[model samples]
Target: MREAAVSPSPLSPSPLSSAAAPPARPVRSPLSGRLAGLWAAAGARCALPVAVLLALGFLAPLVAIFAYSFAPPRSFDVFRAFSLANYAELFSPSNTVWLSFAWSIGLALFTCAILAVVAYPIAYGLAFLFGRWSSLVSVLFVFPLFVSENVRLYGWVLFFIKNGVLDGTLKWLGLEGAPAVLYTPGMILAGMVYTYLPFMLFPLTLGLSMVPRDLIDAARDLGANRFQIWREVEVPLAMPGILIGMLLTFVLAIGAVSEAKILGGQSVIVISHDIEIAFTYAQNWPLGSALAVLVTAFIGALTLLVFARLDLDRLLGRR
Candidate 1:
């Protein structure tokens, strides 16, 4: 038996060799590597066209306006001459532009307050009560947007004008005629609320819809009242939409011109009206550009502030 024993063959595998072997790495071709890199950047590539369009349409105009703001007052030397005269004039003690700014800010704030109160109930109804009819209700709200704003405002004018629909109807029914409310600040505010109601409502509805019903039910089960549930669960969840709606309405209201012109009969001049005058009637393009720059700065700053506080990832559901 000792003589019959033989050494293992030189080429034979060891018992531990297979267990000690490293994993085989896949060999990647250059083409495959390039394709993978492209796939990784696919999202950016897809967004390139939209980015280009925004640069051209939005950013270019803003740049031009900013450049024009630094030009000499009442001058067309945009990008050719640079001066601080336009801005200086705006900040001068004699300038009444501040009045317009105050008016605009006041009106915008009032409009936001009014819309927030008016739209919430409607939004709540749309989100919870009008389940099957929500789409139809939304369409109804949207239908007015399809009509020209000026046209719709004019329709209101016809309805509110003396001896027009309201007054005539009241006289026919042997009641007191409609009050002399047209061509007033109250009227302008009314028009703004009417025009911006849908803007506030839709966003609120969207925000409310994002709130989980189960959480609401759980809160109710935990002895939470309707107000508590709203404050504790609904509001926190729907805050993003509410903020968006308010911001949007505020922006639109601040820029409103036609509402004041048509409804208030220019009883109060707003900043937008001043800008229009500088551009059109006064032919002071530089002044208009400077005013526009200031407005843009204010809006941009406020928007940035709001966005800084907003959790966009949560809003977008990334979290």
Candidate 2:
């Protein structure tokens, strides 16, 4: 009677007591599950269409050019097979190809340098000083777009002609004679500056504008002068825009066919003209393809080199 059945306490410590369980995560909605599946499927569905279009449109044409570069020249029975004739002709001292290339590169480099130097100050003025008038100035800078290129070229041709605006002004100013302004390197330079100034100005303006005023003011407060602040703060910050504007100008100048052709009076031959002659007059598709390919590769390389010099992280660094 005294020996009662003993039962273990329900609250006694168990194996799970010391080991805390992981917190339960909130369950996702049915819509979220469907959205995840849809997102995953999108790339697979779109990839083929995009790839096919690119391949057919751009890739195939480039491949064709490469293949044509290996093909025999038109009307030539000799060297009827693969040969390095096109590449060899590119460097032939007897031809204008290499000279044109050199001249083009030089002109492009000069133009970019000029644009950078000229635009930098204007950009600074617009960003800091001419704040209210920036928009109007920008519009005035880009207003040349209203004139057609054909008309502009012809107008310059007309103006630079004998007894035209330039000569008339020259006589009125007491100068004996005004030399031809069209078909000269000076003319090309003037045209380039006029056409591309906006390109330089806008990118530079945007880049300089992005430089935080707080950092600049802080630098000033810390006994930094204008020159020091520019060198240390503005330069590093605005470098990306400077590089970009220069790159665009360089590319535009270098690849120019029309400017040097019509405006140049066809007397000065550029590389693009050589390529055109190869394809059109000579009907030498291989040589044209080779020239085009080489020019494209060179431009691509130069652009890449310029891009590598810019440090984006540094530009966006904390003040």
**Which candidate has the top score in TM-score?**
1
Compared with the true structure, what per-residue lDDT tens digits does model 2 show for residues 1-319? 6999876577775557536666779999999999999988997788989999999999988887777776665534333568777778776778668888887887787778888889899999899999789888888877877887667777877788789888889899998768767788777766667667877888798789878899999999999999999999998888887888888888888877777776777767778888898889988888888888898899899889988997766555543
Cα-based lDDT for every prediction: 0.93, 0.80
Clashes of each: 0, 0
TM-score of each: 0.88, 0.79
lDDT at 204, model 2: 90
lDDT of 1 at 140: 95
Q: Which regions in candidate 2 have their CA more than 4 angstroms from the true location?
A: 1-34, 42-57, 75-82, 172-175, 311-319
- TM-score, candidate 2, is 0.79
